[model samples]
Target chain A: MAKIRPVGDRVVVKPAAKEEVTKSGIVIPDTAKEKPQEGTVVAVGSGRLLDNGERAALEVREGDRVLFAKYSGTEFKLDGEEYLVLKESDILAVLS
Target chain B: MAKIRPVGDRVVVKPAAKEEVTKSGIVIPDTAKEKPQEGTVVAVGSGRLLDNGERAALEVREGDRVLFAKYSGTEFKLDGEEYLVLKESDILAVLS
Candidate 1:
């Protein structure tokens, strides 16, 4: 992977793989797959600057399994792999 | 309006009014209106608790003009007026 570091409150995520088959045993093609909301955190920004000029600490860290908003974030490609640059707030939950 | 107190990073917002007339003096119908992405903050939730049990303060406050994601938040009516309950993270920017 390329050495890309996200700035304040941004995160780099690798989307989870799509399910190959449906619950009904129907083979779902890539084009028919819904955008996956689950991912593993790859990188995290330092923190967001607060109104008082303090750096607000990020809640999530590297390697966390997180669920994010479906349409959130900007898409980019790094070293032939796809990644998303999203605000830490876009993450809905962290899976245990 | 109803007295609502959002919990844990949630917020109440009043959407900006839609434009009624076009620059050409033609009235734009309500049916053709787009969802407003700008609004004024009405109420704010207490800060979200962090992993270490610290409450992180919210970035916005009541009466702040904000821009939010178009499809974000849960919509409901309060005393015949509409309001949205959104996570503080869903707010994109605070306008000056």
Candidate 2:
């Protein structure tokens, strides 16, 4: 239960760890791995301003797991905890 | 010259290398490093479908270097080269 309040249309995400090992039982190195597809939404901010300048309501609430594309966020760490701040639009799907 | 054509509203970006040596004169390890900022626009797809169902024209053309948030894309490597496909909306700003 990390308290990370994202700013603007940002949402703080804790990326899930890679759990699958290769057929040879080789754990993938961090450098060779891709961006995590799934994340737990720790906190969500008020949605981004629409082109008309009105702040839209956010679609996903906090604690909802979501699917987002890689390369959609500005990566950062808070107190040694890795997280991503992405625009709500970047989130493709919400995991039930 | 690598050829990478993104699909949908996706744009393929070849991330810029981290080149700055720290004050410690040490190159940061990849595992400890963050996502790349600058990128060369290798290819761009037709814009995403708008709410109206029409394809929006992309704001960025191919070959336009741009800045994007780290968590904004789905990362992939093509033929050993790293690239990211992101929705145009995920791009934070265009770098001149």
Best of the candidates, DockQ: 2
Best by the TM-score measure: 1
Off by over 4 Å in 1: A20-36, B1-46, B49-96
Model 1 Cα lDDT, one tens digit per residue, B1-96: 225556458777887775522322333344644433778898876588565546888989999988787677755544456666688888987876
Report how far off residue A7 is in candidate 1 (Å).
0.6
Once model 2 is optimally superposed onto the true structure by TM-score, how far is the C-alpha of residue B32 displaced, in angstroms? 15
lDDT tens readout by residue for model 2, A14-84: 76555521221222225633453666678888766566656655666787765566677888877888888
Which candidate number has the best lDDT? 1
* Candidate 1 displacement at residue B58 in angstroms: 12
Q: Residues A1-96, candidate 1, lDDT per residue (tens digit)?
A: 249889998999997766611221222223422322667789989787766667767777788776566678999988788899999877754544
Cα-based RMSD of candidate 1: 11.6
Docking class of 2: incorrect
